[model samples]
Each structure stands twice: as C-alpha cells, then as structure tokens.
Target: MNLEEKLKQLPNDAGVYQYFDKDGHLLYIGKAKVLKNRVKSYFKFTPKLLPADKLSPRIYKMITEVESLEWIVVPNEHDALILENSLIKQLKPKYNILLRDDKTYPYIYINLNEDFPRLEITRKVLKEKNIKYFGPYSIGARDMLDSIYEIVPLVQKKSCIKGKEACLFHQINKCHAPCEGKITKEDYAKLVDEALGFIYNKNKLVTKLNSKMEEYSADFRFEEAMKLRDRIKSIKKSQIQTGMDLATNENLDLFAIKAINNKAVLVRMFFRDGKLASSNHNYIKQNKDDINIDINEAYSRAIVNYYDNELPLLPSEILIADEIEEKRDIEEFIKQKFSKSISILNPKRGKKKEIIQVAHNNCDELLRLQNTSSETSLYEDLKLLFNLEKTPNRFECFDNSHMMGQATVGAMVTWEEKFVKSDFRHYNLEAKDEYAQMRETLMRRVESFEKNPAPDMWVIDGGETLLKLARDIRDSCGVNLDIVAIAKEKLDFKAHRAKGSAKDIIFYERAGEILKLELLPSDKRLQFIQRLRDEAHRFAITFHKKQKRKEDTQISLLQIKGIGEAKVKKLLLYFGTFDNIKNANLKELKEILNEKDAMLLLNYFKNLEG
Candidate 1:
C-alpha cells in the first residue's frame, strides 16, 4: 500500500513508528502515545502527502525522504518507549541521535567468600554472593588497588595461601602469612578492615601513603619512596574534584547535556556518600545533513542507554541539569527493572542544583575545547582535499592479514573523532589470495548496510587495483560511499615496509578518472589516513594471530578418532580452552559429547600423557 493509504489505517493506541525512504532505508524511529496523531503530525494532507510547515529542519528533511511508514502497536506508552529505544539501537536509523558509548568503567571488588579475600579490579559485575564493590572508577582503579595492597598487611596473592608456606611477601613484611597459620583469622580480618577503610576513604589512604613515603625516604629507600609518591599522585589525579559536598551523605548521579550547533556533550558525575567519586563524558555529533538538535531527545537517549544493562550501578537519586519530557517514564523504567524506587529530579535551586551545575560546567568546557581543537578542522581539510560533498566525520578503514594463505582474516576499524573500538569488526576470510579476500570482506560489509548504514568514505589499504575493487563493490550495492586507498612507496617494484623513508601514495576518483596524489610526509591529512590504515592493519594482524592459535588448538584435537572440526568446535565452546579440555573428566566430556566420543577423547589424552 502507498504511504498515504497506510497512514489512514493507523491505530489510535500507543506504539512505535518507523519511516523508510524510497530506497528502503530507515530514516527515523519514534514513539508516541497516540500513533495516529503522532504519525500524522509530520505530514499535511492537502489531498497529497506533504511535510508539515511547522516541522523543524531536521524533521522536515526526514519527512521529505520518508516514502513508507511502519508501526508496532503496544499496550501503553511505557512499552512503546522501550520498544522505540531498542529498535533505534538495533537499526540505527539515519536521523536518530544514537548513544554509541559502550564503555564499562572499572570497579574494585572483593569476594568475602574466601578465608583471606584479596581486592581486585573488574569491569563487569560478578554473579557471586558476599562480594563488596566500590567506585566505578574511570581511572586509577589499578593504582588504587595496588596502593591498598602496599599499605595494608593483607594477603598479597591468591596463590600465597595455596602454597601452605611462608613466601617472599611474608619475609618482606608485606603479608601476615596466613598460609602457615602465622596470623589468626581475627588478625587477618582486621587487616581486611583496614583495606576496606582505604577504599571507603580516599583522603585517609593518601595521607597514610604520604606518611609511608616519608618514612621510606628517611630510611634511605629512595625507590620505594618514589613509587609511593607516584601512587599518591595518581590517586589524587583520578579523583573528580567537586568542592561543594551535599553534606547529607546522599548518594546520587548527576547528568548534564550541552549542545553547540550540531555537537553535544553528556557529562555524568557519580557521587557516593555525598562526594564526587568519578566522572565520565561522551561527545555526540549529528550527521552532516542533520542540523536541528533536540536536547530532550539527547537526554532521554543518554539516560536509557547508560542504564540498559543487566546489573547497572544505580544511585539513590538522579539529578539532571534540565527537566526531560520522559522523566516519569525513565523513573518507572528504573523502578521496574531494578525493583527499587529512585527519584529523577531537576532541581531548581539549592545543593542539588549546585552539584548539577558542576556537571553542566564540565559539559560546557568539554564542548568548548572540542570545538576549538584541530580534530574538527582536520575533517574540513579532508573534505576539501578529497573533493567530497560532506565532511568525513565517520569512516571505516579496511586491511587484510594472512601468512601464505594460512589463517587469513580481514579487519575494519571505525574512526569517529577517535577509534571506536566497539564498532571495529574482524572477518575470517576463506579466500586464499589477497584480491579475493578483499572482495569477500567488502561484500560481507556491504550486505550488512541495511542494518549499519554506509559511512561517509571508505579507506582501503592497497594500491589502485584494490581501490577500484572497493569502488566497484560499493557501486554494485547501490551505496553512495566515497572510496580511497593508501599504498606504501615501492622500491625495486616491491612495496617497501620501511618506517621513516617510505612516502605513501593515495588514490581516489575525482571525475570518472583515478587520480594519484603524493603529499608531503608532514601533511596532517596524509597522516590521518595513515593512522586509520595502521589501525586497520594492527587489528587484522591481531585477529590473524588469534585465528592461527585457534587453528593450532583444533589441529591437536582433530587427531582424536571421533573428533572432527564440528566436534572440536563444540568441545572448545564447552570447555573454553584446550587446557580445560585436557583436564576435563570423563563425565564432563560426556556432558558435551556422546559417551563413545567422550571415552575416545579421554583415552587419547591418557595415551598422549603415557
């Protein structure tokens, strides 16, 4: 059915709607309480479908491109909100502001289940009981953990207790020697308590370290003193300084968003016990065609994406710089997901507002620094250099690595202001030759364009032939993406790999003709492309080595009588590693495979050992 005809059949219930262009590419996804009213608001009937006059520039552009409409009817607005967010993240519509930050901050945790628990750092929450976690520290988590061990006379290593004898740590007075019964359980508990005190109070820890450093200096132990001094510096530097404390010991999380032109920044400050513990910030940039910025939508997306995890570290109260339209919906989401009630507040005045102002100030300063930085100008120079229609704010670089057709792999790394490690991808290619491997990789990527739309440009790590190959692939897919390739300088008709002397050449199409350009080594544009190519090369090589190792493991397992590639794969998946498989008992092997195959594998291991 036509878009207009479909619009007439819209339901009145709450749901999410998606708009697609004539080319069958999604333009936007949105949720509304009344699907019919919200879907119709973007258009003016006038006997024909046309964009509404009062729409923002961004929405008007989206409406003009939208040729089809799709919707999912839900029971209520809450369901609609959740479904919309999920679809937006999965589909990544062209006109939506996606929160691409998938970083997990570090946390210092201790599992009290052990007799002598040792502090450790982890990025993910463990599914174990009697575990105490502290400070989702963005930095200095490792240094802080080390400082705790250095100061407190706790067990230094997990293996120390298993040895059943005094180790070097005990000799040096760093550990209380709980393994040999040198320290009682109560005495060890006191030491653990001292470590916990340091984790709770940063100032006390630094003061104690300072005192230790002075004592070491007075005893002519300069190296130990210097190490302690560095640790103290790191801990202090990692701390987020918010001079004004709320004075009420209330744990809260503050969010502030600020936008200038098409760029925005989201600053999050985490406070524990009414003091700032750590802060994180993410920069959000709109697509080149998108001019209108929606602060409310940005705020909603940031909050939703941050808390969209299995076990998020939620705060008692969330303070925001500005009131969002979906405040109640978010609050309800948190309560339902975590089964804990929390407040989402926009403080007009007082301590809450002041703390939020600190977040706002951070956002403003980050935006200002980013705006004035050379990175923004570099993209402009790139656009002019390549004769592109729009700035190449986001692009992907491709490289392939192999060893004589063995363990061949291709990698694509994304660069958007920085290397987006989360978006980077690796492909194990079956093709033996370089050209075929490149073709297979590019074809796979092009097939995924429906979900992840094409970037502004593609940087290929090859000469003219491979550059043309990338262009042909994009053209066959009907994707309007620019393509460029960088090739190292050739010496004696062979590509040179020397670092300093080689002058790489760049190839691109300008007007139906391939053009080669060799800029000076000092040019930033050339350096930028080189950096992208280098990152792609590094990623591909790393994947190739990993594939080689896995194949080596598979080769050893494939020697078993009943173990083929599929069975080996299944065994590896269940056991995790070859060492684990070697140590698995007959019962454990039977759980993954049949009794016959499990017995064969067990006998093979026994025979090998014999």
Candidate 2:
C-alpha cells in the first residue's frame, strides 16, 4: 500500500493513525484529530522538493512495508493523544521517541507514628498510613538537598556522632548534640516541630524564629541569639518567591495561554492551602477551526471542556487564561458546581500579574525544551491527546479467557502510573462464547467497581467489537466508565497460498469466538490481542486446572469399595499414589487400608478396577 492508496482510505475527521513495518511492528504513532487535514499537510504541494529531517527517514521506513491502515475516531485532538499513548505502549512501535522512566519521585517524610518522627527521605506517600511526606521532590537539586540538611541542626537535632563526644559541629556551636544525651529526647522531639514548621509552613517558621531570637537576646544569650539570626537570614535568602499571600481559605489555579505555529500552550500554576503547590504546561496541536477562533473563544472552550471532564479540584480562587465574556455566568456556574464563590482573576498589574508572568516564563522554557530536543513528557502528551480531565495516574485493563467453551474466566490487571498492581483480580468467567465471556467478565468487573471504582480508564483487550461489548456490559450493570480495546492489527502483506488463501489475513464477524485472534499464519492483531488475552487465559487456566486436578485425584480414590474415607486417605498418603489400592495385593492392601476394608478393596479392584 503506497501513499496514494493509503491516502484515499484515510478519514476526514479528527483522530489518530498508526504505521507498522513488515515484521508487523509499530514504527510511528501520531495523532491528527482531522484525519485528511493532518495527513495532507505532510506531503508538499509545491513543485520544489523539501529536505527530510530525523523523523523523515523513520517515517520513510514505516511506509515501505505499509500493508495495512488502522484508525480510531475520537471526539477531539486531546482525545487523540490519550489514544496515541495507549496504542504506543500497547504496540511499542520501533520508531516513536518513547519516554523511558516511569519511576516515582522520592519524597522527604516524617513518621507521625513515632514520638519524635524522624526526618528521612522516602518515595511513597499514603493517607491511610500515619506519616507525612513533604514532597515528590527532585533528588538532583543540590541547593534543595542542602536546605534540608541545614534545617536539621537549626531544629536542634544532635549531630555529635549520635551527639556523643563534642564534634566539630558542636564545637562550632551550631549543633545541639542531642545524640550524646546533651539534650533530652523530649526536647529533641520539640525541635522536630520547628523543622516541620519550617519545611511545611515556612512563613510561620520565620515568625517563630524571630520570636525565639528575641527571647534568647533578652536572656543575655547573645551567642545563641546570633546563631538563630543567621539561620533566619539564610532561609530568607534561599527561598524563591512563588507569588501570592492569600488566606487559608484561598487555593488558586492560574492558567495562561500562548499560541504559536498553529499550536497552543497552556500554563497552569497551582496554589494549595495559600501557597504554591505545583505547576504544569500543556501543548495542543490546533486544527483549522481552532486556528480561526480568537484567543478568548478558544480559552472559553478549553476551560469549559477541561472543567467538564476534570472538575479540577476547584479552590476558592482561580486565574483565567483570558477573560471570558460570560464571567458572571461562569461564576454562577462554578457556584452551582462547587457550592463556593470562585474569584476569577485577570491580573493586569501588581503581584498577581507577577505570578502570571512567572507561569508564562515556565511555559516558554518548556516550549524551548521541546523544540531543542526530541524528548516529550508523557503526562503532558497524554493529557492533550485524551482530552483527559487529568493525566491518568491509574489504569485497569480487562480481558476474557476460555478453552473453546470450557473453564472460562476474566482478568483485571491494574497499572498505577506505570507499574502493575498484580494483586487486583483473576476472575472466573461464567459466560459462554466470546461475547458472553466478555459480558460476564465485565459484569463481575463492574460489580467490584460498584463498591469501589478507582481507575482513570478501563482498557479492553479486543478490537472494536470487544470494545463495544465491554461498554454494553457496563451499561447493563449501570456502571459508567471510559473504555477502549487494543485489537490485533490486520496483516495485508503476507503471500497467497496455492489455493489463493492469504497467509496473513484475519477476519471477524463483529462478535465471534476469538479462536484465531492471533493464532493464525500471521495476524498483526493476533500479536496485540495474544499478549493481553493469553495472560488472562493463563491465569484462568491455572485456576481451573488446579481445581480440576484436585477434584480428579479425590474422585479417583473414592471409587474404592468398603475402603471408607479414612482408609482411602491413609492409603493414598502412605503410598503417595492415586492407583496404589488398585495395584496392591491383599497383604499390602491390608497393611495400608483397614484389614476388613483391604479385603473389600482387593475384591473391588479384582472385580471392577482397571
């Protein structure tokens, strides 16, 4: 299939398309909500030819063995990105620049369970657990690490080799040497409050620090007072001002829009509990309609769509990308949605504008970062592609399994961020055939979810047919969820046989047994489906096989007449055999089985056992 032939079949609507190589490997994955519009832009209409870059050679290779085309039609461009990443990982195409690390960032934690919670760094944070973590902070920043170190001594924590004999730090009068028992455990624990107060509540810490300094000076402890003063000065100098000093009731999110080259970038700054929490930047490749729309209209559409899906944890205040003409209406809308008065700001000057400027600067930095390098953040791209309210942190995949028509089962595998949580479930599929198996699998899945639903997306392991099947089950069970199927890619390049039967072709009658899903001479969809389906099948088969084997062994021994449960169990355990009674002579049977039962067993074996 050449470009002309492929172009003729491509759709005009906005969606995503993928390219595969001859080995049936995905080579390039991309999204263009407008199918024809995006594809046409790739080819030059001018008489003069253009030079190709790094992506050019890769795409050229992908087109070479292009035997088939596949596409997914979604609501918009953002949804396209979400779909793109889902496919990219599902297919792991050879050419797309993939993000490698999926590790969670380490955080600084204080265990609340201890009388004196120790200050240590950790990676995980849980609300149910009795501990508090300060950050998912960067491990590489030297200054940040130094700041954490500095707080240790100022909080009066002992540094004297467990605070034993006077160390250099104690000699320098900077350490309290609590480890040497110079300070009592209770006093040291009190110091923990100061350290936590500093890291978690910097403003309050500064105020408390100044008060402590003044009190020390008044008591004629000039040396101690001076040390306190110096520490306060250092903290002030190191702190980077993230705009705003709002009250505790106000948590704000500010969004700013910047567009260039037919793409729009949105910058978001988050303020939680009256302080800057975190920030993010997103880029959206625009269609012609978006390009023609003014900034305000685009902003309105984007914000409304964003909130509709995400309902971002609305704070008391918000900052807008552009002033919506329906500000009153938006306020009323938010009030109805959140039951709180939300103040939307378009800061023209002062600290508010400064905060907005800071957000804009970060956006520009991110844009430069992307332009200069091929690397892209998966979180940003996924959010843009899926039009997801937020980046998917948790996802669950479902697949059904059966052997022809027996021992059917379903399985749910979960991926939090990127790591699999294998303990979730291996369901026993109770329904028959492909459709019923899927239905039963999803019904059980939704039932679990009805009690506790906690996934951003539920991925199915079949194509369009199974995708719809999963949804229908969810509907019947009154469970609402977003789902998609990762089907086998059709193979159109394999050679024809003597009878003209193509070796690579795969067919589906919408909903039928997945007997040959990927078990054919060569089917692209087969590879994709088998990975997920086989896993589900393996889990199901393991469960059923264990049960079958247990039952079979038990029934085999039960056939012995007059043996009774006790004698039959003993003979099996003593001989470690299932056919021991049938083979044993009368004397050997008498020793293992009961004396009277042994004769009956011998008679039964002689009479009927084979």
Candidate 3:
C-alpha cells in the first residue's frame, strides 16, 4: 500500500504494531498508546528522523521489508503492554534487543509455612507456593545465609539458641525473645505479618515505623522511640546510596542510557521493595555513524528492544536519563503491561534523578571491565597459531592404527570452527601396511572433499610421510587445500613404553619444525589442534580394534585337526566369506569336507572352537 493510503487507514488508538519486510518477515514489534498516531509518525517524519541514519547497515536490512504493517488493538495502554511483550517473544522480531544470556538471577525466598521460617536463595519463581521472595540479587560473595544472621533477630523470631535466658537483643528491648517463650504465638504472628509486609512493601513499612516512632516520642516513651529510630536507620543503611528517592514505592526500575560518539551503555538498576537488588549495564557496539543522528531515538530503541525480550518483573516506575519522544506511549504501555500505573519520571532534582546519575557512573565502571581483557577471539587465534593463510573454518585431521601391521585401519576426523564433526570416516586398510593405509585414507579424504567441496584446512595426525601422502591425494583428486600435521614421538607407540603426556606430542606443519606446541601453551589455536589430534587418535584405535577381532577369529579356526593345510585352504576357498562358515549347515559343510572327516568336522563345528 502507498504511504498516504496506509496512514489514512490506521486507527488512532492504543495497540501493538508489527513492522514487516517485503518478504513478510517481522522486523520489529512495538506498542503505542495511540496506534494511529504512532504508526503514521514514521512516514510523516523528515529524512532526518529516518532509522537509516542511526542504526548500522546490519539493522538497515530490515527497513526494505516495510511493504505492510499490522496492528492488534487493545482496550488500554497496559493491555497494549501485555500484548507487545507476548507478541515480541512469539515472533522474535529481528530489530530487537535479543536476550543473549539464558540465566535467571537468584532471589531470597522465605518459607512462611515453616516454624522457623528459613530464608534461602532460589532461581525459580514459584508463584503457586505460599512464600515471600525478595531481591533478585547478585550471586556475589555475601551468601544469602548471612541474611539470616541479622534477619532472624531483626524480626524477633524464635531461634535454636537454647538453655539460656533472653539474649542481649531482647534484654535491650529490640527482640521479643520468642525462643524463650516470652512472646505469645499471637504476638509472634504479628511480627511475622510485619516482616512479610516489610519485605514486599518496604516503603509502606518504613513509613509506618516512622509514624510509630513519632507517636512514642510524643508519649515520652524515649527508650522505645529511640529503638524504632535506629531500626529505620538500619534499613536505610542496607540500601545502595544511589541517592534515588521514591515517595511511597521503593520497588522501581531505573534506566540510564549514555551515548558518546555513537556508542552507548545502557544501565538497568533494579530495586526490590526498598533494597538495592542488582545493577546491570550493557554496552552496544555501534560503529560511529557518518550522519549525526538524534541520540534520544537510539536510546529509545535500545530500551524498548531490551525490555521487549527480557520482560523483567515490571517495576512500580521507570526513571530514564532523558526525555524520549514517545514518553507518554511508553509510560501508558508499561503501566498497562505491569497491571499497575507506573510513573516514567525524568527527575529534575532529589533522589530519583540522582539515581539515574549513579547509573551513569556505574556505566563507566562497566566499560572498564569489558574492554580490559587481552584475550583474543577463538577463531582469529586459531588462524594465527596454526600459521595458516586463511582461518581454519573447516579443518580435517587423520590418524593410523594397527596391531603389529595386522588389521591396519586409518581414520580421518574433521573440525569446523571449534566443533569436531564426528560423522567423518574410519577406513579399513585391506592391505597389511601403515604407509599404504595412510595413503588410502588420505586419498579417500581428498576424493570425498572433491565430490562435496568443503574448501578448508587439513590436519593430519602423523609426520612427514603422512603429510606427503595427503598432499599427493589432494593433487590426484585436483582438490587444492591447506594442510597441517601433528606427529607424536615414535616411542609413543612402543610396547612397555611410558604413556606420553600432553608435552610429548609434537605439532608439525608441512613447512615448520616439529616443536612442542607447549611453547605457546596459552594459545587457543594450539589447544584446539591438540583436541583434534586426541580425537583422531581415539577414532583410529577404536576402528583398528574391531578389524583385529575379526581377523583373529578367522586365524584361530585354522589350527583344528582335519582343518589343516590343503583341506583348510579348500574350506577357506569354498566358503569365500568367514561369515558363511559361521552360518553353514552340516549337510552343506559335508559336501566340502572329506567323508571320513565329515563326522569329526561336524562335531568340531557344533562345539565352540578356540
């Protein structure tokens, strides 16, 4: 449809909308308080407001598919919020902040049913259970058990400390000493109720406590009033001094986005009840754009995409670093989605705005941690470490095995990136030779690659002879490829020889010295090659064992009486296959056997042979 025609048809209402490519693939999913107004704004805006100026070329790919737009109308802003979250997850729109990590933060769960009411940290949110959870906090050094040390006494609950009078907390009138039976079950239940209220409704609890302190002081209960004052101070001290203050709602989500030279860091600070749950900062790696674009639009896309995929527990409010163009729409959408009217505030002064500034400071610290590491990308390291002109995107390794040149077999393994392709080949030699077996295996590998060209590097698990054979096969098959070899010390296969450790294996390329790769012990490329070599060795040995078992069984049958010399040779020649002898009937065998020896041979065949 034409831009004007589409805009005229759109309804001015709250809803979720999907933007699709020419091929009908969903590019982005978003919600707006006024569906008609929001959808129309895109086409109406000048070239300066185009997404092409801000997002990278990778993102621009989605813009070509703007052939059609679809919308799902909802009753209110919050309904739009819920629908947007559900649709984005189902469709997994391309132009969105993908949830990179699949992990949940831990929350401290208090089992209200338990007599002692133990507190434990859990990853699951078991909503069906009658339990209270607080703080999806950091998996930091301070264990959740440590919370019990202060929490148990703070609530004046029963403890296991026995055969003693009231503890100092109770003597000082801070605790009711339920362990010593000084407090009744009814009174203790009241304390439990207060604790639960404080956990889930921190701001309200603190407000009530403050009021109680004021009333007690007015009644001249100085000692009682002083205790409440200290308790309030203690709770405040536990929180991160982010300088963020909310009037009645302590549970809030604060987001701060900073853009410097087109790069951005998004800081999300989560507050639970009244305590600091955790703060997470994510940096967007965007190349500096040629056209200077509005930073606010970039920030808006970042936040929307993040929340769309994550859909973390909706907070009572969101504090942004700056004003966004779709501020009203985002606020209404969030409030409806969370089933609570949440404020989207840009605080001018006081604790709320300070919280955003604190989030910004935390952003600086996050950048330091991410960029300081000297570790190289795994693929790049592999390419340099192996000294290959091209990266080892598809690498092949080979190994040979035999029991004293008997039942010889060769195996070829392939590595693509960091993964070993297990479905490769293990071939029987047919000829009783190691060099010939290596030649046959290499020939097969080259031929296979020729038929199905997976143009890449090769890693042979032998020295000069094997490497040369592999190259010859590549030439014969007319398959040009890069190749390397890892040869173990000759003594590695000797009988009664000590087993070789990692240090014993020498990594040899076609052109370089066969040195211990251990010199570059820290190199990721060498480590990857070592794993491939180990895998090739394992495959070759396993195939060789099966070949040996079959050959040994056939050779063992040659020793029986009347199954000797010419007769045995005749039987072997007539059977043509070893498996036939295993299944041959007595009558069928009698025709091949001499008459006098037929009976003896039948008895031998019926009985188990060595």
Error of 3 at 353 (Å): 2.2
The TM-score-based order of candidates, best leading, equals 1, 3, 2
Candidate whose TM-score is highest: 1
- In order, the Cα lDDT scores of the candidates are 0.84, 0.55, 0.61
| Candidate 1 regions with alpha-carbon error over 4 angstroms | 22-24, 46-48, 74-76, 206-239, 287-292, 384-398, 406-522, 539-576, 581-610
Better of 1 and 3 by TM-score: 1
Instruction: Provide the lowest-lDDT 10-residue window in model 1.
Output: 305-314
Better of 2 and 3 by lDDT: 3
Q: Could you tell me how far off, in angstroms, the CA of residue 517 lies in candidate 2 after the best superposition? A: 11
Q: Which lDDT tens digits does candidate 2 get at residues 57-176?
A: 435444545554567788776566556644543343444432222234344566667544557655544444577655333222222334444445632342334433656666666566
What's the CA error at residue 518 for candidate 2, in Å? 9.4
Pairs that collide, model 1: none
What RMSD, rounded to one decimal, does every model reach?
6.1, 19.3, 20.4
- Residue-pair clashes per candidate, as listed? 0, 21, 7
Give the per-residue lDDT digits (tens) of candidate 1, residues 1-610.
Answer: 9999999999999999999888776778999999999999999989778999998888898899999999999999888988887777655677777665634677788889988889988777698888987777767788888989988888898778888789999889999888899989888888889898887778898999999999999999999999998898889867657787788777787889988777888888888777777777878767656676888898898887766654436689988899888899988887877889889999998888888877888888898898788888898898889887556677899999999778999999999888878679999899998899999999988876644556778999999999889988876654556789999978898998787788899999897678999999899999999999999999999999999987765577886667888998898899999889988889999898999999988888788779
Question: Over the full model, what C-alpha lDDT does candidate 3 score relative to the true structure?
Answer: 0.61
Q: Would you estimate the TM-scores of all the predictions?
A: 0.78, 0.38, 0.43
